[model samples]
Target: MLELIAIFAAAASGDVDQVKSVQQRDEDIVVTGQRTEGSDDYGVSEQRTATRLPLSQKETPQSVSVVTRAQIQDFQLNSVNEVLATVPGVSVLAAETDRFYYSARGFEITTFQIDGIGQPFAFGIQTGSLDTSFFDRIEVVRGAPGLLSFTGNPSAVVNYVRKRPYREFHTTASAQYGSFNNLRLDSDVSVPLTADGSVRARAVGSVLDTDSHLDRYHLTRWTGYGIVEADLGPNTIVSAGYGHQDHDTDNAQWGAVPLLYGDGTRFDFARNSNTGQPWSGWGVIDRQIFGDLTHQFGNGWSAKVSVLRRAIDEDNELFYVYGNPSRTAPEGINAATGEGVFSYPGKFVGPTRNLTIDAYVNGKVSLGGRSHDVMFGIQRGAERYRQDAAYDFGQIGVAIPLSQLFAGTFPRPPFRRSTACTSSTAPRGGCPCTV
Candidate 1:
């Protein structure tokens, strides 16, 4: 009888221990339902990319597509190109190994935003592969978004929402490897700096090195981003951040390979073959600094001001080869001797800088038992860039055998550029009020 009583007592103690563990687990989880950075959920409960006002997917009038952090991780969309390819009605164009462009609804996308502030692009092309490590989510607003965005492009507006520093400490790391010798590593860390969790900082970095299926093509890129947020009062907050990225590509083709030989007959080439010299390459460097200030009033009203400055530098060394190839002599190439020639080697450098500032206030008002939302916003931007100077490389390159070209055995001579250079500056500003 005494032994049976002892067993019951022990069972009661075990139940108490389990209950304590559950309580501790619940306390450790921080769920505010306001932020989606670390949610690991495929869809967001609220979105504000279309308009500064908070609204759900169903409430927003425009067609919106949100690519959350969970989707980015699950689908391995490490670069901006890969992420956009998954969005509906969007098309990605690879102009070359380093340059890319995107289009939606049969029109080129010219407006891109970061945290609901942006500048219109004069040329609708993106240089280098933009890493996706720093973004919490990407929002695509199809059709015209001129209600908020300054530019009235009929295509689409892409907004990249940055990940904010969490109130609690958290860290995550991941690595990926795939075909063609591709390897990627990503790391994100968030830390609270104040005892009351009023100050926080976050850092994100990524590195990627890979070789393409195309012959002699290779790419290496790395990115680093850091941000800090501090709460000044109960309803006010300020934040600042900086980011840097470097992308370098080697053996990038300037143009497509010859489709037909000099003869009328077809000249089929291997799928992996490319008409590029081994010495051709392009490199780009990007740096950005930004800050934000936000405040909330008691009457469901909020105001925010954001500013960003971005700079981009590019260096290009391109080799273009064009000619028809045929086994028969005189018509195209003589496979026996290996002799053909069509090559242009050139080098150029260009630099661009931009500064943008945006401020907005939005709130809700009730009248006659009905609530209405209104917003007023202003945006100012300036861009300065040097024009591309075409360098003079005397004479065409000497003829090299087709076999030698395919074997990566080609000579690269030095290029001389012009002494004169020109630059241009563009300024833009707008004020848009919506209700």
Candidate 2:
């Protein structure tokens, strides 16, 4: 055994000397390198969502989950809801076809951030679906980060990080087709705008047109995003971007189906049955313009300031039906015999706008012969929301048969004057909300 070991060591030393001689002779040698920036990976080495200080998942005090670009692409998670549904300890609750609510740790998640900045929602909910085309990664903190997120929600805080311009020119695109007539296309491009590669730009967009399995239901959505980043100096960077999303859904359900008859008998309905009229739809538009400035000091201290302006508008034409039908067999609740079903049809439009600013300074200091991280931040936000609704009390009180509702035989009721005040005409002080 000792002789074999000696022979192996001599062979290894001889190979090392031979390689050194080749290098000294200036022989042609190929050098290769890899670029990790903007590359696809399932996990990241560090994250700052938990406390705004860089820490790995294992180092964070609270539970943290990072859905990286590679995971999203592999799972085909196009919507924010789809992405969160895959996370552990997080549940996505669907209120309807497009509306969703999220919960974690048995508590509802109400705090959502974009690049670590939170914004107020118009109706206390995300109005439309947020696409994942422009996002690089999603960080989920399965607990409260009270320092940054004002709301001390014990559930979780979700932060969406946008994709930045890569120093090298790169592009990617994909097309997908699936069941239910779903077709989707997306494109992402990054390019260097300056000779030194210090100035860069990126753009991402996606389009989706799909028909659901439910009868008379369909959806159309598209999103666009563009950003430009420039290095003002060696340690300073400034970036600005704009993003927009448009969502249109047809034949959206407003209420659930009745599972029991008035006589307390179970009723079986078709899985594909739709209770909404053909004209019923909900359209939403979302837009945002954001900019940020970051500077690094030689003393290991860094400062960042960010500003964002967001606008959201939605138009709703909906019909809600609810009632237990009689056990009259074939014609339980038809047009002629409207015994138990009732309908509420209305038109509504809501518009919301907000402006938010965030600034923070973070650094490490030596305390008691040990390094400790410290961060100080301030956030300011202002928002305005207004809704206008058209209603007719008579139509709301009328009874409509369930059979006729599904058959699309009933006609739409005439809309009367809007009872809710609009933002443009309302006084600055306030207006009466009749909705």
Candidate 3:
């Protein structure tokens, strides 16, 4: 036994020229040539909305623009409306104080999505009012949306790509202040839950409080998003998340003042002029729960299914004014005294609920002698909006001098419970409200 041990020891002592590295140290690996993939570049994108076939931005048969994260940061775009205003040919119309509508190519953009799954457009909605803090990028496609939506619209389609969690820990924060008491703050953090990074979690949140250029107008908004991702296997993943938005506005408006007075006199008003009452505004709250599952076959074919359940609650108090009035309805407007009679004073309360789900499969296929990307997909959605009807508090007699809004004092009218409207089709839910 002693002789055998001696011989083994001598053999284990290898020659000076023979050596092996059993483990690699940190210093041994250096990434000197590493570069960021999607750094701040203003140009076309590599991927776009899929339509049963894979296509690039340049190859897609429509105009496409990718609002990258870098551009969003550079311009400090806090909301989707602000981001879309930067797009050429798109118009952001301020329908009210926090209620904005987006129009492009002669049509209102009513379709919205997150990660390629459609989100319901609320009734009497002000599109693009969503907080953009949780999005990694926004892709806008102009013209007919085709199969991308359940019932496609003629205008543009916007897809908000959410930030994905990687097998790394990263965190970032930002704050900004602007005119009219504008203040916004945002933060995002991501971390791996497992040592191998097969599971991960990310959280993003923001707060915005500001006073508008309009007199007596104020807005407050708070938003939060949280997500968890699990890598089921080498070719499968599952993700779930929840997002919330709570917004409130004071002194909201329903319409702009008439352009012409009773005497057919055109008054040039200041751009910032507002006719909103101090007690009128909106209180809106929205929440969503979303989940996604994706699986990839070894042959490069992948399938994905995504679903979202959304609920919205809104409280609206409105005082709206309309066009000029004739002698038949003499109280419409009095040009001589700058007396304007608004349509109605009411409280509209409603809740909106929606559910949407979509599934798709895509892969590369050989046709003739060329390789082409092909995909097959199907989507379905349903929504129901219920309201308790608006309380027609009756119109008020106010004096708003054209181009001189600050000089006037507006009063909140009392709720009129008696239904004495002359219209035969008066909406009895609250009272007949018509212009």
Candidate 4:
């Protein structure tokens, strides 16, 4: 060992020289070159740079936009509709304070998804708005995402990504106030459960309340989301999570009628209707439950399954005066004893139910040194609708005496009393009149 060490030192020092002779061949030889501190090694940075996915840009196969939590916070966006309004090619028809008609790319988006699974539909006169507090990101894919989503409008698909737990302990909170007396508070906390940080958990919650610009309208919302993740092994991870949101609105108005003068000119309804009492008001309540499980195989493959249940209830009453100027009598002398006409009040109520089930598998595979990402899924959904309405006669009371009839007093008459009295074929109770 001593001789071997001495020979290696001599060779390294360049003190020995090589020769063609057998005797010289036994001597060690040294080669001269500059020594580098480290070898050229493949690293995370190198791999990332060498095989980076292209940033999404115009001309991509699909039109996609990403709304980050930071952007939502910056804009103080509270609902999905608010966020979507900022995107191009998206519009919302606010039928009422809580009810909305959402369309993108020239088509209505009736279906919604969270974490890429079908969420229930809030049908009928009710409203459905996605809360921004529970989501980490929102991805909008324009054009048919049929390959990844099912039973959705071909114009677009919205995927909401929930916040997940991390191995480190962290907490964040925020509060905001805005126009129309809007206020909101939100908080999130995440921590590891085990010393190795293999298991992690996180919780997030928020509350918001506000009065709308419309008369006698207000909104309140609350949401809670939690996630649990476990590192099964070096190459595998499993996660499960749940989220819930409850929303309520009171004194919501559908919309003001378009006002027109007798001359066929448009008038500002806001100014005119300001004097009239609210003809309609409503209360809406909606709740959502969501759960998901995901597992990753050792290979470049993984699977996720998610389920969501949403229920909605809404109560609405519309009060309107039923009358026709053309049916009025002469100024005085009881054109039947001419007086002003009376107006009957009418009200309508609507309710609905919706359910959806979605299941899918997503995975990636390597072939011929290339990676392919693929997703295939199936979905089934259904909705039920119901409605009822009632009408009532106001101050008019019983038939007015002809002696009391005067010029501007307006006439008060039952909708079908005369018709019912005249026709034997009329339905029982009264003539079936619709408002």
TM-score of every model versus the real structure = 0.84, 0.86, 0.80, 0.65
Best candidate per lDDT, number?
2
Per-residue accuracy of model 1 over 181-280 as CA lDDT, tens digit each: 9999999999999977789999999999999888988999999999999988878889999999999888887656666755556667787886566777
lDDT of 2 by residue, 1-435 (tens): 654555567568887675555454443322211222355777788887888887788988888899988888889999999999989999998656667778899987888889989865434345457899978889899976666687657888998998888778989999999989999999999999998778999999999999887888888999999999988887788999999999998887765767788777887788787777777777889999999998877566788899999988878777777777777745565445554667777777778798999999998999999999889999998887787777666778566555575775556777685767655555432232212
Clashing pairs in model 2, backbone N/Cα/C closer than 3 A: none
Q: What tens digits encode model 3's per-residue C-alpha lDDT throughout 1-435?
A: 654554455558863222222222211422111112147765544544536354667678888877878788888988888899998878888765666777889988888777888776653246226888878888888888867776468888888888777668889999999999999999998899999778999999999999977777788889999999988876788999999998888777766666765557664557666667677777889898999998877455788899999888877676666555432225444666544544545666667788998998988889999988778888888887665434433354443333334332556655544333322333422223423
Report model 3's TM-score to 2 decimal places.
0.80
lDDT (Cα, tens digit) per residue for candidate 4, span 301-418: 4555656665555454432232212222332112343232233433434444556666555567679999876555566766554444454454332232222221113332223222
Look at candidate 3 and give me any clashing residue pairs.
Answer: 52-375
> What is candidate 2's TM-score against the reference?
0.86
Model 2 residue 338 CA deviation in Å: 8.9
User: Which scores higher on TM-score, 2 or 3?
Assistant: 2
Evaluate all candidate structures by whole-model CA lDDT and list the values in order: 0.78, 0.79, 0.70, 0.54
RMSD, every candidate, angstroms: 9.5, 7.5, 8.9, 14.5
- The order by descending lDDT is 2, 1, 3, 4
